[model samples]
Target: MCVVTAAREGQQAGCLVGFASQCSLRPPRFVVWLSKANRTYRVALGAPFLGVHLLRRDQHELARLFGGESGDDVDKFARTPWRPGPGGVPLLTDACAWLVGKVERRADWGDHVGFHLTPVEACADPLPRGPLLCLSDVAHLAPGHPG
Candidate 1:
């Protein structure tokens, strides 16, 4: 699982994502699918960049915050430690690994939209704190928005 963040104008939004992966190796491309019903998706539609944060196995609370709480009624950033990244996107400080990517393209795929990305900046802990948080780790979380 990952948390994807975006900013457009002065508005920022983020959400937990279960559908994301590296789709290319040569040009180093990645793809993250955001539910059309999510507030983060709405903000991302106009954002030029995105911050993808890989969660640590121990960060269940963080996952719950992003995955189970709706941005429509909550300020996730005020509850977490983060900094403005490239293009003013929020970058989670507690991530085991993270990257800021330029939005290359977007495609409609049923209930979700796929954002194709090209990495612009990235960081990884030299000694990871734990294994990556996986889908099973967050399976109990109810989505912040309708699917």
Candidate 2:
């Protein structure tokens, strides 16, 4: 899974996301799927900007931090170094690559809602990075709280 951080209102939100991809090449668009059960999804509903971060292999801790906890219960940003992006979306300071996108549309896709965003601003520091975190890396997941 990859990390996609978003911000809106007075909240900065992020999660370890597995269902996302760059869907269009010409327009350079991406899609992030989120469960309706997540607080991040609720905040993202009206947000104009969302930050997509590609985690380095060493950032497994970051994944656990975001993926294992619910934002409604924890201040996820307080534990990480981040700043507001173009439209106030939180951007991770140390990600391998980051993109600030404008959310163009949202639609329900089965159990998850798909947020399609067009990247308006982006930055990268390709450091011959280690392997990226994937779905398999975080399989058999356990949430920080009991479900």
Candidate 3:
């Protein structure tokens, strides 16, 4: 899972997204699926931008923080070093690579909703490119929001 962060109307939210993929290549589109029950989903609903972070294998702690705890109950940003991005979206300082994607569209799918993104601004740390954290890496994690 990768962490997705967004801010709208001065409220910020982040979460571990299990379903993300590059859906298009021409215009460079990506999709991050957020559970309707997840707090981030609520914040991202009308957000103009979304920050996508690719986590390194060693950053399992970050994965746990986003995937295992609910933002409604815990202040996830309080534990991470993040700053506001282009549209005031929160960007993680330690992400292997990060991108601020302008929300092109949002689709409602059963159980989870999709945020379609078109890359706007991005950065990648070239020095420490490592193995990416994947679904199997944290299969034991209890979701912050099961729905």
Candidate 4:
């Protein structure tokens, strides 16, 4: 699982994303699918960049905050530690690894929209504390936006 963040026109949004992966090696590309029902998706539509943050196995609470809560009602950034990244996107401070990606393209795919990204900046902890947070670790979470 990952937390995806974006900012546009003074608004910032983020949410827990389950559908994301490295889609290319050469030129280094990545793709993240955001549910149309999500507030992050709405904000991302106008944003030029996105911050993708990888979580650690022990970051269940962080996942819960992003995954189970709606951005419509809460300011996720205010609840967590983050800083302005490239393109003014919010970058989660507690991520085990993270990347700031330029939005290369947007593809509408049914109930979700896929954002193709080219990495602009990235970081990784030199000594990872633990394994990555996986879907199973967050299976019990109730999505902020349910289809």
Candidate 5:
């Protein structure tokens, strides 16, 4: 699992993203799919940059905070420390690794919207410890939205 965050018009949004991966090696492209029913997708539509965060196993609480809540009704970034990246995307300081990407395209994929982004900037500091968060760990988690 991964966490995707974006900022637009003074609002910040993030969610636990499971349907995301590198799709093109030639162009260094990455894609994160967000449900159409999700609030994040709506905010991301107008965002110039989107941030992808790798969560360490011990950071399950971070995942829960993003995955379990919707930004429409809550300020997910309020309690977190973050700064704007290249395109003004909110990047979390506690992530194992994070990347700021320009949204190259958005495609409708059934109930989810696929956000394909090209990495504009990236940072990696070797994770000191703990495994990356996995899908199984959040199987029982519920999204803040009814969607």
Candidate 6:
């Protein structure tokens, strides 16, 4: 799982995403799909950048915070330590690794939206300690948006 964050008009939002992957090799493109019903999707609509984070096995709490809670009723950022990434997107400090990407395009695909991103900046834990969290790790989480 991954946490995708965006900021707009001084407001920030993030949510867990299972539908994201590197989609291109030549020019480097990554796509993260956000549910249209999610608060993060609303903020991301006007955002210039998105922070994509890779969570380690030990960071299950971080997943629970983002995947199990709604930003519409809770400030997901307030519960986690983060810093401004490119274009002021919120980057989770506890993430195993992260990249700030510029929005190349967006597509509406039924219940979800696709964000095509171009990596602009990135940081990874120097030690590269743990295994990245996978779908099974968060399979039990009840989505904050449930869409």
lDDT (tens digit, per residue) of candidate 4 on 19-136:
9999999989999999999999999999999999999989998999999999999988999999999999999999989999999999999999999999999999999999999999
Colliding residue pairs in candidate 6: none
In terms of TM-score, how similar is model 2 to the real structure?
0.92
Residues 51-122, model 5: lDDT tens digits: 999988788778888988878777888867888887678889999899888999999989999999999988
Pairs in clash, predicted candidate 4: none
lDDT, candidate 4, equals 0.95
> Model 4 off-target regions past 4 Å?
none
Residue-wise lDDT of candidate 3 within 35-135, one digit each (tens)? 89889989999899999999998898899999899989999999999888999999999898999999998998998889999999999998877789998
What's the CA error at residue 102 for candidate 3, in Å? Answer: 0.7
Models ranked on lDDT: 4, 1, 6, 3, 5, 2
Full-model lDDT, candidate 2: 0.83
Question: Which of candidates 1 and 3 is the stronger one according to TM-score?
Answer: 1
lDDT of 4 at 38: 90
**Residue 17 alpha-carbon offset, candidate 3, angstroms:** 1.0
> What digit string (tens of lDDT, one per residue) describes model 6 on residues 3-117?
9999999999999899999999999999999999999999999999999999997888999999999998898888989998888899899998999889999999999999999
lDDT of each: 0.95, 0.83, 0.91, 0.95, 0.87, 0.93
- What is the RMSD, in Å, between candidate 3 and the native fold over all Cα? 1.1
Question: By TM-score, is 2 or 4 better?
Answer: 4
1 versus 5: better TM-score goes to: 1
lDDT of 2 by residue, 20-68 (tens): 8899999899999987778788788878988888887678778888889
lDDT of 6 at 79: 90
- C-alpha lDDT of residue 116 in model 5: 92
Q: Model 3: number of clashes? A: 0
Which whole-number lDDT from 0 to 100 does residue 93 have in model 5?
92
RMSD of each: 0.7, 1.6, 1.1, 0.7, 1.1, 0.9
| Residue pairs in candidate 3 whose N, alpha carbon or C atoms collide under 3 angstroms | none
